[model samples]
Target chain A: MTRDAALLLPSTEPVTLIDPDGHPVPHVGHDLPDPQALVRAYAALISARRFNDQANALVRQGRLAVYPSSHGQEACQIACVQVLDDGDWLFPTYRDSAAIVARGVDPVQALTLLRGDWHSGYDPHATKVAPQATPLATHLLHAVGVAHAARLRGEPTVVMAVCGDGATSEGDFHEALNFAAVFRTPVVFFIQNNEYAISVPLARQTAAPSLAHKGIGYGVPGERVDGNDVAALLKVLGAAVARARAGEGPQLIEAHTYRVQAHTNADDPGRYRSADEVTPWLARDPIMRLETYLRGRGLLDDQDVRGYAEQAEQAAGRMRAGLGEETSADYRDLFTHVYAEPTPQLREQQALVADELSREEER
Target chain B: MSAEKLTMATALNRAMRDAMHADPTVVVFGEDVGPLGGVFRVTDGLTAEFGEQRCFDTPLAESGILGMAIGMAMNGMRPVVEMQFDAFAYPAFEQLVSHAAKMRNRTRGRVEVPLVIRVPYAGGIGGVEHHCDSSEAYYAHTPGLHVIAPSDPADAYGLLRKAIESADPVVFLEPKKLYFSRSEADLTAPVPPIGRAVVRRPGTDATLIAYGPAVPVALEAAEAAAQEGRSLQVVDLRSIVPFDDETVCAAVRSTGRAVVVAEAAGFASVSSEVVARVTERCFHSLHAPIRRVTGFDIPYPPPKLEHVHLPSVDRILDAVDELQWEYA
Candidate 1:
């Protein structure tokens, strides 16, 4: 049996196309995305960042229960989702609201779970995006399953499952990766290593050289990318998607980034981390770097910048307006949708609840 | 339709084959299910009939198997996944409880997980730990999961087909002990409906409600009870989660006495549920308090002590005798 040479000597450096300063950097064998695509990705990143800010504001206003802001990781979320085809599926995690919004899920619907509502707020079938899983790494196996089934049915479909660095420590993560490799499922796993899994940091999660290296053990090729670099993320994730669609099995793309905000509206980052540790990451801000690159390449001017800003503002306003409407959940919804046909016991329980509700109405 | 004698294993295989032949989306998969025809051989000749794409072996991971089945089901494929053994299903409990059970509801009916998780459960063959476990209680406790267990060949074939055809997720528990038990059945006859019970034997003295592995033991007890001049009615509860309480209550009301039997532990089991339901519905029937003939509240013991641990015909008879005692 011939062993992969790269598996024996894995690359330590991440695949990077541009530096933190937005200057072109040399990388082996990877080309930049076309100017139009880069510009579009940049627009998505800005919009996602604005959406994150609005969602945080809504949480403060008591309109939302919580919001896990994907502030610094906008480039990773936007670029990874931008590479998928209309028919392909995207499986995202709780903190992946930016990715969900980037994939055409309405901002209000994407935050519905965090809003403590019944069911996932949007139809996953309509958007080709699975419900944003709050349980870490669980959706990975679902992604692999869908991709494997698609392959079995001779469908030219690939699945992208996005998870956090902390999620890689979950057992489902290992099972998903191993199953994908063994079954040769057409899946691409994108890990945004954003430093913390709530209060826990990456160091506490794994002792491996990197999360990407974990894929090598599962017979999956691993690639690391600058998560803050939109062009690099698009390039690496796009290639991985292409490889999966071509039936080359699965690959793991570890995007190195950091979480810029607290875990959520309820969390206090100051309790665990100091501001000094966060200062250096501010220089590598994804939106600023992308704007710099676009301005330098003459693709963006003052008018274009103002236009993009107006679009972001309008999107945020739409989210605010959507949240402003009052939507009441039906109490009977709890009994329905649990099964195709509710069991006899369920029917009895539903009647009991209905009676109680009626009694309360009379009262 | 001509009648032929077939074992429960062969009946289940035929059920899978028929379902696969009927629907192009029906896929069967699990560890050892494809090539070895499963360790129980219940899936024998399936992979040979259907190609590997339809019937295949999965990696030896229960969570991955079930998770993939859920995905396939959501994507318009009817997937029937097998858990290699009863206790082996524990690894996939998270997937079943969190995703498989909650998907259709979580998606608000935009997608339905038309998946069937077949598990060979309950002990009588004297297997070691982790091999023989009656874990139906766990799945039954979870909402959105339809838990069904069949005893005879006819119900086995019929229930397996209904489960695969159902739009909801079903935990189809096959009694491992009944796998080799043969019965004469017309293969082409109309199968029974899902989530209903059938009367194996009718009488008036007492009612014996049993399912899966315990059904045969209950029938044997009923025959033994007949010799003692006590006519016992045997009710085979086909499904546990959507239990046929109406049939159970009707039998209990007529007989005025009831005994629930199962190989699973008595605590929080299907037996306890039946006893509770009978007591609630048939209180004025006035014979005696319900007695549960079930396995002891302990782990499945070693083979040597399995007979003592499991509810036998004599134990069921003893419970039936207790049903004659007057209660306050």
Candidate 2:
């Protein structure tokens, strides 16, 4: 279990397995996930990066209104998703582009949200997931509820709720942790400590050392893992998930990562942090780490690497194609989904719009 | 009949138990609900009868209790989440609004969160602030969430069942003031439907609309007006949000005058909607402006001062007294 105490928090104490130097530590047991699993994780992360990149390009091309990239933070997301079964649920926040994708949410689904066409990124019921909650830590409590319900049903399903580090400032985070701990609900809270919540750094968010160590107050097992280390993250996340599924309780895993890309398409990281600051995290990239690790094992070659890159491109193209197939607005659906059975007031509004359109057409 | 005269607390227990027996999907959760049987003992003998799993105690967090009900509802279970008090629910409002209310629509008609959030809502029991305060208006404003409140035991049973059965998330506001107000409530008989307003007394002078704590106040005002030769009609508006506009409209159209009464502050209340809608629908029928007998727009005062804050028999009579009744 993760010992989440102030002493282990990253601000007061450093939280890294193999530092940026790529040197492995002996005490920190790296139950390194299988090499094949590592390759798989790298593939998904790379694909997510491609998807985010393509979407960014599309945004610039006047396709999508905005796009948030999971550029340097795919390790924690894909790793955590690898730990859970299909029955398990995921509660993702606005910036978790990769996390939502790994939870069986199509990249194109989030386009609806980016286009401001719909509130939900995807069908939560179909994926056993929840809509991407734009609000910060508030949905964390709902994730806690999912676990509590699983316990009520005598089901062994666990809910892994993902959020950014800055979300720790919100009262809802404390409530969710306390509830999960007290109830012993089967939940794993994955904090993708992406360094900044749209500009408010982790420093402004909490005085309580590390985000992981802060969970001790609620008595939930907490740990900080190298968000760039897919192998380590998956291993720790797998065990924590197993513990929750075993009816032990909730666990908080803070994935220490950096957002190498802009917070979203609209954000300018240059104003807050310098390009020099992002240089170090860029070197410790999750995709590059797994790629380097696989190369060292001789399990992958240059040709295979090129093939994987091609697959990422193909996946992005397919996602772009899928975006085209979505239910378009036609200006009619805009007024449709507001309510199930449109109120008389809304219907009147719709009729008025229709009448104006008819009059224009007659002209 | 298996029905016996019981306190409001005991009646809630019976209704919950019967609900569990009627549907295996029914489950309840709140703080100290298991062996403790809740702080008020309303859930007493329930954990024993239904077992700890079905009628269980949750952690101290009220948000978790309510949020989990939405999850259970998604999984095809009828979860009656108990908010220990009205104020504790503030933490979970995001879940209630962003998740619970929008889930069905967000899923594009693919999902329904059939959850019941039972809150011991209202003041006068002197819970200070956190435990008191009638904040039903907040839920009513949020679409996709159904809001219902019941004063008497009979309506409590039927409405609770209806709320549990409804496919939408329901905010079931239980008046704490009426929890111990014992009276004859038929358990065997089916009362008026959950959302319908029941006309307790029929008259043409004015329509007195109320629910929860204000229902008794409205009834008392109707009786006092009758003694004064004033034929005031009373409507027990069972549901607050997605409020019984049809029923409230019917009463107002019949009487041609309206007085909305509630334990909450008169400012931007669920009753505020009632008055606006009533006046809008029955505009020409008005003999006088819509009057409201409500709790003052201030913090719930001390126990002694609570009488001054909440609507009393005298306040409604005062509002009714303001009206010009045309009939003999």
Candidate 3:
């Protein structure tokens, strides 16, 4: 016979539950969250998912060239972003537009950057975030650099470098963490451990048993969080941010989650994995699991569901309307943006560009 | 004109001292560059005179040093970063390529970074491969940076001073082998414009082109050729980028046959570009194909092989021999 809660086995393992229907049950820790706060997180997740959907549609319609999905990682994004204080810096990877949205960026700005426009999404300082960088693990050092800047300026700021699990395989990642740990720079590295990196599996990525343990090599504390459980993620991120803001150097966090869809709208994962492998995770979906837990505690109902759907739809509609309404960047932007003082060579190059453009106009 | 005899190293130190004295925002820092006075002592007594804040030693990390300099530059400070050796610049490449060269373009001209990278460059020091390598071509190919090398005490003082005062990011390549070589420094007059090349000696037969340490080699070759009654014009292409094609074209048009020389390798070298531009601008005016006397097309050799690898006085004379011979 099983014992009661008081007589249960003592273990350091995280709390888990099983649904009565032979399905894995969800956690109630985040279920007990405040209604307004939960709605903010829910609203952000919905908006991000809607934007991801529309961006793919743009790619298919040929309005945009490529789209990388952030569909199933919405909870990990919103939860981690909730703990950032004002003036906190983020070195975001290419799959981090959801976090960027939560960090106060207008969706059109991301569209412009994705369209290969010369201007970045937003000023790194103005939005407290750098534009999404595509090169794997390179932005990790940039985040450490930002943390060092904060240390020198005596500003109580925490820098978060968010990347995928595949990014840990890069030398720059280890270099950044080692630098942060040795220098005691105020930085937190958040890895959204989404199972695949454009088709490369995490199992093929590392042999350390867990991605979280990789930080130990650099003498930094690390944690593993249930990324689908918004409450667990928020709690872990809040603690990490607090430690960093207190000048305790850095923390490494591995947010374990699964992608309920393909790597992007362009690919079919069926070539790699079966529908059966992903079916179970969809039933325990991040937003769905949170919604069920909230409903279990009487925090959500039909009306709340209706409101979130309406908000997400309207936001998507606004974005769809604003897609091509933004200004188009010119070729002059290429050489103009490179140097404050365009070298004599650049000036000559621009003159050559102008001459060619003028000839094209004549034709 | 007041003249003083100083080695190339002392002249550089004096020029830097004058710059730091003239501008409050000029900052200097790198490895072993403070109390130890740099490996070559080119920055000797700088820390003592300017205080530790302005001239100090940085952490051993190259990326960290450059990353901090970029931050300082963005914050309205003109930082002069010393990349310990020519090859040490590789570690700082990301900061140079991704940030320093692109900050203005990435920001759409809203922000400008006027950072200067001063590197002790090229071979002839009894050092190994990395120390003797010439990386000027790598930076010259980058679109946003201005790369320039000085061939003499006067050009070194003037170009470095101008690079410090310039509003753009400049790669100041200091020829390491010439640092200790004694030179006459004219303390009286201001240095000339950095963007133009000067003709050291006018010749009617062939144009001998070079810059930095190679300029002296070209000069010596011209003097030796003169004893043989071959009038060779030596043109010093001081600034690599924004090359003084006005003077180069004029020289090529007059001399008809041009012999280019560089310490860098012949294949895809800076001199290769020089050959192309001079050939293109003065195509029909050519008395013979543009001949380039340069380092061999291989990884920079050891100190023992350097004499053969680099373009020496004999190599220049050989290139002239290959050019239209006016000896008859």
Weakest 10 consecutive residues of candidate 2 chain A by summed lDDT: A6-15
DockQ, Cα level, model 1: 0.76
lDDT, candidate 3, A1-363, per-residue tens: 112332222123332332312234455432334556666777777777887888878778766666777778887888778889877877788788778877878877766666666546566657877657776776677677567656766789898889889999976677777777776788889999888887778989998767777777777777777777676677677778988999887888888888777876778898888889887777656777667666776777889888988988897888777775656668877766665545566778899999999999999
What's the C-alpha lDDT at position B127 in model 1?
A: 94
**Native contacts, share recovered per candidate:** 0.72, 0.48, 0.28
* Candidate 1 residue pairs that clash: none
Rank order (by TM-score, best first): 1, 2, 3
Residues A34-62, candidate 2: write the lDDT tens digits: 77887788778877778778888878877
Clashing residue pairs found in predicted model 2 = A9-A210
Q: What is the interface RMSD of each candidate, in Å?
A: 1.1, 2.6, 3.4
How many angstroms is residue A9 displaced in model 1 relative to the true structure, after the best TM-score fit?
6.4
Instruction: Kindly report the interface RMSD of candidate 1, rounded to 1 decimal.
Output: 1.1
Tens digits of lDDT, candidate 1, B1-328: 9889999999999999999999999999999999799999988988999989889998889998998888888788999999999999999999999999999888777778899999999998989999999998999999889999999898899899999999999999999999999999887888777878888999988889999999999999999989989899999999887888888888888888889999999998888988888888899994888898899999999999999988888888888878765552
TM-score of chain A of 3: 0.89
Residue-level lDDT tens digits of model 2 in B28-51? 888877888877777788889988
Off by over 4 Å in 3: A1-36, A119-121, A296-301, B1-38, B41-80, B91-95, B110-114, B153-169, B184-195, B200-205, B325-328
RMSD of each candidate relative to the true structure: 1.5, 3.1, 5.7
